[model samples]
Target: PWLPLEDDRVRRLVEARGPKEWPKLAVAFNETLDEKDQRTSKHIRDRWTNHLDPNVNRDPFTVAEIEIIRGAQRRMPNEWTKIAALLPGRTDTQVTNFWTNTIKKLARRALK
Candidate 1:
């Protein structure tokens, strides 16, 4: 689902399905947006943030990064495929890639 910028096929899929699938796309897009909103809201509500990483960068990962991992383990919602479908701008593949890459990165950092 990771639509690379170079990929024209997704554009075609969008063009072909966009108008017809507007409502469903909007639902998916909104779900993704909702998760994003949750990410922001959680950041505001979470007071124990520094308990994990005092110097956590205020990037997309800072809070969401950790929560995603925790969510994966806790299985509060659905599997990552469902989560991937709901991430704001990231495609399923992108989410998979983020998990694949960042999880390793965090693990490596933790080992030290």
Candidate 2:
């Protein structure tokens, strides 16, 4: 389920130049792959930023983090990215998923 062999190189490139060069980096990466395995720039960037970036926190959310997320969501409804900005180590996808899957469900149950 993981293709981590090229992750180190991807991380180095992104760290050196940032995500702005992701398209060019993707092209270069595709050049080294077989045609059947070629990936789109968006796919490459999303994979690195969302899953492979070392800065991303895979740990369980703490109580404080959940409170922060709740407060931020109330201020900026579906704006996951803005909410995520207030919580270090959390990606927008992670924030959105946690809110939709955990927090919202708990709230619904509490109200019932």
Candidate 3:
């Protein structure tokens, strides 16, 4: 019998597989993030914060995820260091990780 991979098990496999496999597993992760809380979708709420809901993007993150990240940062214009100061439970280093990645991804898009 072909037992489809269990949810947590499949995601764990994906994590070990790395972002190179993100496209293949993105939907699963998004669904898990949605149902994880079973109240409202974390992915949806995050998209709201990222301004990419259906009222916004009509889909979850995509190759367009980078664009959505770029747009949200523009709407803030913070140093991210500053953003960390304003946010609870998140460090500047964390924000900086994303900030740097955002810039690199945007640069790649611009190069195309």
Candidate 4:
């Protein structure tokens, strides 16, 4: 059974404190809901992160920045952390997704 987490109780638990409180909150969620649908600390933390304003945490990559990411990726393929380090303000997931979604798609289109 899918337990929807958009309820007021879940929202209260998420907004109650910072990341440090996620583990405790996850436990609380288990107690409040069902033990079978247990939410991990990471799940709680991700929910908090997802709720944050995207503009505050992420920005669109400039052309020069994309070039930098491409160059770094060629040098160290699949090394997301290294690629992210080369591009300041970008997370590993951002870099990897850009490579997979944007860059790779561009390449495929060019080849076709």
Residue-level lDDT of model 1, residues 19-110, one tens digit each, is 24434434433353455432222321122122222333333544665576567636743366677544454444445556778779989999
Tens digits of per-residue lDDT, candidate 4, 1-112, equal: 2245444455677567544677787787678556666768777666555444242246678899889987887888889888888776667777777778986788899999
Model 3 segments more than 4 A misplaced: 1-78
lDDT for each of the candidates? 0.44, 0.84, 0.47, 0.68
Off by over 4 Å in 4: 1-25, 28-31, 36-38, 49-56
lDDT of 1 at 107: 96
By TM-score, the better pick of 1 and 2 is 2
The better candidate by lDDT, 1 or 2, is 2
lDDT of 2 by residue, 1-112 (tens): 3377667767777787787777898887788789988777887788887888888998989999999988888889989999999988899999989988996788889999
TM-scores for the candidates: 0.37, 0.81, 0.31, 0.58
Question: What's model 4's overall lDDT?
Answer: 0.68
Worst 10 residues of 2 by lDDT: 1-10
- Model 1's C-alpha root-mean-square deviation from the true structure amounts to 15.3
lDDT score for residue 67 of model 2? 92
lDDT of 3: 0.47
User: How many clashes in candidate 2?
Assistant: 0
Estimate the TM-score for candidate 4: 0.58
Which sequence of candidate numbers ranks them by lDDT, best first?
Answer: 2, 4, 3, 1
